[model samples]
Target: MTSPAPTLLRPDGSNLRVLVVDDEQMLTDLLSMALRMEGWDVKTAGSGFEALQTAREFAPDAMVLDIMMPDLDGMAVLQRLRQSGDDVPVLFLTAKDAVTDRVAGLTAGGDDYVTKPFSLEEVVARLRGLMRRAGTAHAAGAEPILRVADLSLNEDSHEVERAGTEIELTATEFELLRYLMRNQRRVVSKAQILDRVWNYDFGGRSSVVELYISYLRKKIDAGHEPLIHTVRGVGYMIKAPQ
Candidate 1:
């Protein structure tokens, strides 16, 4: 018999609230049900306006937002949130698979993106990744510092530095780097990265991982002995300089 999916719980054994925003009531309901199954507190909004209101009231730990809506689009809502200094992590949910759309969402400070027709498990996994990387799901007394070579990450402070020089990272970038650093010296396949970092097996493109790897190399490996390496016909690995 197939086993039931496991629920994701916060480290403190309390519910982590999530706000699901979509113009489609069915989608919001479906997402709420999925999130609730994970023992998370789930709230739904059927419009951009409602999402904004609910987000403020609920103060969710993370949000799943739809890109298209009447009057106020997801981009505009996100812009408003950032403008007001609300740094809540958000995952964009949309049917638009265009590169520009994805770029726009990321540029607007979205932490992740999932296209329409996504699986419930994938969504749950992605949210779990976001929460864990954001320190929302980490249990008390967990290791707060991770280091490889001169690169160090402070999980509590959400800071990354190498060789005493501070490095700034987007939430997604930090999550990707954290995953790599945690498995340092182990070659992790792109599929594994997708599942671990994004919490989903994204069918969109493998280049997404390559793109982030390139981004990391620029920030983490620049002017240093290259710590990230590609295994021909395999995957990627991060290790200290020899």
Candidate 2:
């Protein structure tokens, strides 16, 4: 699938700010460039102490945090941030490549995580998700609001609400739901979904689509009349319960 032009998410007429925290200069440089290409304001920190200082000064909408550092690990930095009342969305970068490391980050209040040697696309996609879910940023080129039945999504604010209740979604889940909402009741095949949401065919990874749809159903259709329906072999559709 061809990639769309990058969309900037400017909050309050200013570019959304993000901080990349990692000890490696080369990695930070590369990550910062990718984020800047997205038209976001980017900053980098080389250590946990620097991250804390930059977090206070930059007040980023979200963070690309690393789990390992010399003096203070990302976990400690996150703890201090929370203790200082900072609730910024955090996406952790882990070099350990272990479940314990991933779980530790999440259990310590990290919002999302990606292992080392990850693609720039994955990191950018994740940061976009985090910012959108936090309502700290928004899309610029599309109709800001999309709706089907009582479910409404704001592309600009990254808000999704069903009926009168606001729902919280992770970045991937949010993007998947956005695609379904944009298509409304039209049936979308798994291949179409994979391309649209992840920006690549990803080796025709349709099972991931099925997985995310189920996730959306649990949140979007559980207590309410189902808005997401599996069309058997045809893929999926989101429609009103009437």
Model 2: ten consecutive residues of lowest lDDT: 195-204
**Could you give candidate 2's per-residue lDDT for residues 1-242 as a string of tens digits?**
98784575766768889999999999999999999988889999999999999999999999999988998899999999999999999999977777777778889988887888999988888787667666677667667888888999887767789997999888789889988887888999999887667554446668899898989998888888889999999989988878
Measured by TM-score, how close is model 1 to the native structure? 0.71
- Which is the leading candidate under TM-score? 2
Please give the RMSD of candidate 1 to the true structure: 4.3
lDDT of 1 by residue, 69-186 (tens): 9979999999999998888889999999887888889888998889988898888877877887777765345577999988899876778999999999987799889889889999
In model 2, what is the error at residue 220, expressed in angstroms?
Answer: 6.3
TM-score of each: 0.71, 0.76
TM-score of 2: 0.76
The lDDT for every candidate, in the order shown, is 0.86, 0.85
Q: What ranges in model 1 sit over 4 Å off?
A: 1-13, 139-173, 198-233, 239-242
Tell me how many clashing residue pairs each candidate has.
Answer: 0, 0
